[model samples]
Target: MISVVLPARNAAATLPAALDSLAGQTLDDFEVVIVDDGSDDGGATRAVAAAFSGRDSRFRLLSRPHRGIVAALEAGIAAARGWAIARMDADDLCHPDRLLRQARHLDANPAVGLVSCQVAFGGDARAAQGYQTHIDWCNSLTSYQAIRLGIFRESPLPHPSVLFRRELIDRHGGYRAGDFPEDYELWLRWLEAGVVMDKLPQTLLTWNDPPGRLSRVDSRYHTEAFFRIKAGYLARFLARINPCHPRVIVAGAGRITRRRAERLLDHGIVIEAWLDIDPDKVGKRVAGRPVLPWDAVPGPEACFVLPYVACRGATEEILDRLQSRGFVLGQNCLPAA
Candidate 1:
């Protein structure tokens, strides 16, 4: 059986929608565990209560003080009785077949310790904040490629989309709070411990993009903490993947990419070149590498592309062009150095 965990805090406005989606799921062999974090809005608790009122024994609610998301998720994980644990967010909605599909994938591929699926933007779909592009870019990655390309670093597997083995969490100890990012840290641990993770080729989750969310209310989600968390793991993984110091090429000569190039150069990885499609940046130099036009670069046999930003369309377009010229990604190319 599958156990679905939803950790909520002041999610009254969106909680009902989240629970409704789960209630409509085609798979009924799963249980719902909602951990209510200390919520001033009180919507989370109300939503949980409504979801369980006169319902079957499958739904369970656990309440706790506002000790942050890690603590809440820990409570839900501890209460979960199933061998497989799936994650759902307080505000996001799951597809009707999400659990069924994820469970089947895990059962069929025993080697996979965790699985996630494609997610589309909900709430407000017209926001030009790159949601459409993000969906397109995220869906392009295969299950193996997502895990191999340092998935946590280059736009994580989308936390709400994951359904992983409970044993994996027990062995590593469920989510921890503080300076480290929870999901990214867990993904790193899975990689370090050699736990395989896969992604299904279908969209199974809908991300609710609402105004005044925690990510926007509190800047923690967009802070330097995630960067540090990602960078540490990326360094360790890259060192393992390219022991001999592979030839590196960085795209987008921006501040972020320039800093990344500096970090690699400091670590003795030869910078093959810097690239940019902007005419103004085409002839400049950054971190001692000549900034060349995108098409001027040599093959990946002698270089790996490390684009700075997650400009999904631009990145994929460049990747396709480079890939067509016999560049195998992960082995020869990487994203966001």
Candidate 2:
């Protein structure tokens, strides 16, 4: 059985659609554990969940005070009875075959701890272009190695689309409450603990990208917090791979990019130099490190290269260039954007 954990807070407006999608799933052997995280909608959210519970015996609702998503998710997980726990947000829609496909994949690949399917963005097209790009980039990383290599660059899997093994969460002590985004933090923690994860190529979920989403409003999901989280994980990963603490070369020279990279420096990771494609920026100094042209990048034996570039095509170009130079990815050159 697959337990679908749906955490809702002030989600009365969207809960029905989400619940309806779950009720319509092709896979019938599943339970929905809906945790109402203190919705102040005058019991409207509870009414909706209660209505679903009345109609579908598989749907269960749990009420709790406003303790945020981390706590709510934990509550749902604790109440879940399935071997695999699938996540569903109140504002998103799941494809009918999502659970069936994901569960089958897990049944076939027992070694994978977590798996997420590609997502389709459902909102204003103008505001969703960035999200669409993110979805596309994330979907490109379909293998465990690709996901691991790009984990620091971004959240390799969509949180709501994920189906996780119960043992995986239990082994890691469950979701952690922190000043950073919980989902990203969990992924980082799992990756740090050597948990194997992958993504399904099919888009089995529709992600709602509304303006008032938690990620947009919560300070904990801000850019700086993400950077700090990335830096912490990157430092640990680099130390494990290169115990000698080689001076690392950064691949972007922009001030904001450099500032983010500075977090790693604070963790005692030395910066050997910076690399950039700009002719004017070349031969200049950034944060006391010389900015060199692409051709001047140090060989794999000398130092490790980290790409901090965020441009559309630049990351692929950088990866190709590094690979062409015989610097194996995830070994000597890792993308850290």
lDDT tens string, model 2, 169-225? 768877888888899999999988988897888889999987778988999888788
Per-model C-alpha lDDT, please? 0.74, 0.89
Cα error, residue 306 of model 1, in Å, equals 2.2
Each model's RMSD to truth, in Å? Answer: 3.1, 1.6
State the displacement of the C-alpha of residue 301, model 2, in Å, after optimal TM-score superposition: 3.0
Q: What is the TM-score of each candidate against the true structure?
A: 0.84, 0.95
Error of 2 at 46 (Å): 0.9
Which sections of candidate 2 miss by over 4 Å?
Answer: 242-244
lDDT by residue (1-337, candidate 1, tens digit) is 8999998887877787888898888998989988888777746465564567348577787877889888888888888899899999988999999999999999999999999898887855566465555566667666675666746334557788999999997687678676656777787767777888888888899987677655545545664556556665665666666533545677777776576455655545566677887777788776666889866887666666666554445666767877888877666666653
Instruction: Let me know the TM-score candidate 1 reaches against the reference structure.
Output: 0.84
Q: Candidate 2: lDDT of 260? A: 85
Worst 10 residues of 1 by lDDT: 260-269
- How many residue pairs clash in model 2? 0
